[model samples]
Target: MNDWISHFTSLTAAPDNEKALFNKARPVQWGSDQIIFHAGTPCNQYLLVLEGQIRVQQISAGGREIVLYRIGPGESCILTTACLFSHRPYPAMGITETAVKAISLPKSVFDQLIGQSGLFREFVFNAYGNRLTDLLTLVEEVVFTRLDIRLARKLLDLGKHAQIIQITHQTLATELGSAREVISRALKEFALRGWIRRGSGQIEIIQRQGLQQLANSEFVSSR
Candidate 1:
């Protein structure tokens, strides 16, 4: 009884419908870093996350990975929804970022709900559209934005609350679609500027305002 209905803002399930859905869904748990889906594999079921985070990412043939987005509590993966509708293999990989609890709905039940419930349909489509927009934004940043600015923004985002981030350079590189050498070089520049201090798998934001300026420096000449 995960109360799946509350996750969708557009849908309010009737008592009977709610019970049916709850009974039909299979509860699943994934530990941190577990692969939920692999690229080129067909998705067997749609997932509704009840707890924790799932990271969706794409890997290039050269082994470079770029994170597309994350699905958290009360969220579902739009890519899996597309796979279910199109009857195709997943185009990217999904992994658990933390220990996750979810409910898996078989294709038949999911399709039935989509066909019978207008609110569910709306919710699904809206979620798909929002994720599509995020992918597009990521593409724009990767193609048009400078790496330094993107890295700065990413650091500010991660260290926003605690002013310290516990992550490896390679991990940060993966998130920004850059190489480890590039991230290391950029971090060195930030260090020289007295904005941040880097340690083993950690970064401390010493001058938050200065880092913010670097992160927001859109007009800086890109080399």
Candidate 2:
């Protein structure tokens, strides 16, 4: 079983019960920024992340990329679950944000495990539920929230542990599902208000309180 229990502590199956699953799932690895799955591709395996991060994102018809969610250690890709259950091609792309290591169960074994193992069913369904909630929350934010408020909140969240955010305007645009020009203008406004300072490929937080105030405000920025 390769002692997968050590990495995936959230999987609560008894050792003997889990052995069948772990034995069937072969280990896989990917380098950082590698595309693991392309949009519209059929999935033949289900993966459980053992280390590093995988970013699942969707690109609009206009070619704007927005992150759907990230799967980290001990987490599984809900998209993979959806694909396996519905027997459809991937609706979005998956890329490894960091060098990743995971255990991959073939589609046949995955299907069998879901039917034959109660513990496996729980693990898969629970992950699906949680990721679905995240997607819903993201949709709500995009539709109901202002872009400027969301941008301010993103800055505050990113700088929670540091004053400097090591990112670019285009990257922030991608993160917020907006355009680079739009994000650049908003950041310029923030800079004008003395809330932040834009540097080469980075932004320094000058006034966290100011950003906090804006993040809590209801005034919508014209994006």
Candidate 3:
């Protein structure tokens, strides 16, 4: 119950009563690269990530997996709202990037909590609002930012990890909505510039500051 309360607090303000109602929620584990849920599957529960990262990807009309976003600990999956309000199936596929621990609440329990608890309702609203903003930001980035700049920014964002960034060219292509050859070319360009060094299974950032500068630079006459 205490753990459940903590998880709820991280997501939104849950009153003591609402938290108590969720005390019986069970925790589920997901192995690395496991599929938590699939697109178009019937969404019966709300998933709250307690640990690890999950990738939300959508298949485009061209049959390519487009990375929607990554959700880490303390984030709720998209099915939270869809299961409650929509008749159409789950919208996106959720794949675990690492071993994951999450709590799944039955749709009926979630609806009961929402109906009986104002705090719970507010939490859901805030969570969805934040997710909406994130989606919009990603949309804007895709529409306005150049592919090279986006790749640089993504590399910089992943640089915070001490371990080598373990992503293949194909995976990078899917995440960036580009072709594998394009990602390979971009990596090659970065390597020639001495900003990054690629290895068999990972990419190491040799000049993180330069990468940051490239990520933050404006459209200008000089690089």
Candidate 4:
């Protein structure tokens, strides 16, 4: 109960309702890389992540993949909630990025809380709005911005923890919604300029400032 309360502000405000939610929720676990839900699958349960990350991505008919968003500890999925309310199958896929511990709420209990608790209602709407805005931003970037800039920014993000990023070209392509050849060409240009060192399934950032400049400007003409 303490863990649930701490993770959700809605639960924290309504201590009395916490017990009801706890009674209804079933704890679930998923291993790394496991599929939590697939595209076209019916949405039956609402998930509250207690720990680890769940990546929500979309795959096209041509087999190209693009990451939409991620759900982490203390967060819920807006897409899941929307599907439940609209009674539609999921249009995107959700997979566990790491081993996860979460709580799955039945539809009945979810509706009950939405109707009975103001705090919970606010939490749900706010989460939905925020996630919706993020998805919209992704769409704008994909449509209007240069792929090279997006890829550079993504590399800088992954390189924050360490200089070396252990990811393949194809994975990076998927992350930025580009093809493998496009990613390879971008990486080749970066390497030629001594901005990074690339190896099998890995890239080492050599010039942080250079990558930062590229991410910040439209200076690098899109190839």
Candidate 5:
């Protein structure tokens, strides 16, 4: 129990105070490609990732599964936060990329813990703030960054963990808020530069540092 409390406490600031409230935590298992929960489903519980990857995605009006973000181990689902305060259905779907282990707590318990513990509240507050900052950064990228530059940055970011970094053109398009053809062309440009090697269902990052340099050139130039 001390180790478990210490793990979460390291993620934030206060551990001893929030430890008791998590005594009733329940474990949930999700298989690969399984939907942990669907968009618009009633939110009664929240989950904290213990293993594997979970993606938060929403379908656009045009029927694209736009990825909001990827949550790895040590991150909690945003749907959990939404459920704690509101009765509405979750706004996005959580899909497991690999077999996943998570801890689920009733919405009421989650709220009570946060409300009674300053350290727990601070952690959730910081998590929410980080999410907002990420969203704003994505919005700014869409509004002001060139499509090619954005694509390059995304490639660099995703390549950090992926061994083969496989993603379809349609998926890339959805993630970038652009058409498939546009994403394809940008990828082709990267291929031409020897920065990546394109495949039918994937693009292998060949020159990660070069791609990163290209992504950061604007900042470098400003400096």
Candidate 6:
């Protein structure tokens, strides 16, 4: 097995630490769309994703949701780390967006490694700091940015790897923390302008430049 720790370039390799991690880290997998953790659930293991994506999100009692962040290859969850360290249940939920492969380190092993391994400690804190920054940015966007600009940007980002994005407006609203009707109205404006075409549960980009222009300028009005 490849020293999975190698995926994280920030973690300097030590033979002893690598050996210990290898012995204790259990490989795990989850199918796409699986719920990995829920709010108020105690975290039993610290996860380091080796492949695929796990989306961390917060869902409200009335079924509204806002995506917090995604944990992808070479990354770990800050929420999981916080839970492990603080002995607290998860504040939000983690669900697999795709088939996921990861290493699960038991809480006891994680505690010991965080104490003894400088590289491990550094890696943990750095990941935490980076995710914290991302969350802060998300907060800023949700608070002050216009929804149309965010929607354009989000569509561009989601369409990067695929020509057609498979998502519903309701899901997109959940992503942007807005009502479905608001997202539909924005999307209608984009469609009327010949930028995109929306179908059942799918969105196809008709003109990338149009979206690029909208996503880049905060001053550009729909008029």
lDDT of every model, 2 decimals: 0.85, 0.89, 0.78, 0.88, 0.77, 0.89
- The residue-by-residue lDDT of candidate 1 on 104-216, one tens digit each, is 98998888878876666777788889989998999888887888888889988998788789999999988988788889999999999999999999999998888788677
- Candidate 6, pairs of clashing residues: none
Residue-level lDDT tens digits of model 5 in 1-223 = 3334544655445555566667767778889999877777888886777789998888777766667777787777655586667778888888898999878778877888878877667777777778778878777777777878778888888788884687898989878878898899888888888899999898899888778887986632121
Candidate 3 ranges with C-alpha deviation above 4 Å: 1-3, 10-20, 161-164, 220-223
| Runs off by more than 4 Å, candidate 6 | 9-12, 15-18, 161-163, 219-223
Clashing pairs in 1: none
| lDDT tens per residue, model 4, 104-194 | 8898888887888778788889999999999999998888778878888999999999999999999998888888999999999999989
Per-residue lDDT of 38-88 in model 3, one digit per residue for the tens? 867887777778889999888777767778878887778655475667756
How much is 44 displaced in model 5, in angstroms? Answer: 0.8
Q: Mark the 10 consecutive residues where model 4 has the least summed lDDT.
A: 214-223
The alpha-carbon deviation from the true structure for residue 206 of candidate 5, after best TM-score superposition, in angstroms, is 5.8
lDDT of 6 by residue, 1-223 (tens): 5477677777646566555665788889999999999999999898999999999999888878899999999999999999998999999989999999998989998888887888788889999999999999999888877788899999999999887999999999989988899899999999999999999999999999999988897653333
> Which ten contiguous residues of candidate 5 have the minimum total lDDT?
1-10
lDDT of 2 by residue, 20-134 (tens): 6668788899999999998999989999998999999899999998888999999999999999989999999999999999999999989888887777788889989999999
Q: Candidate 4 — number of clashing residue pairs? A: 0
Flag clash pairs in model 3.
none
RMSD of candidates 1 onward, in order: 2.1, 1.7, 3.4, 2.1, 4.2, 3.0
The local distance difference test score of model 5 is 0.77
Rank ordering of all candidates by TM-score, starting from the highest: 2, 4, 1, 6, 3, 5
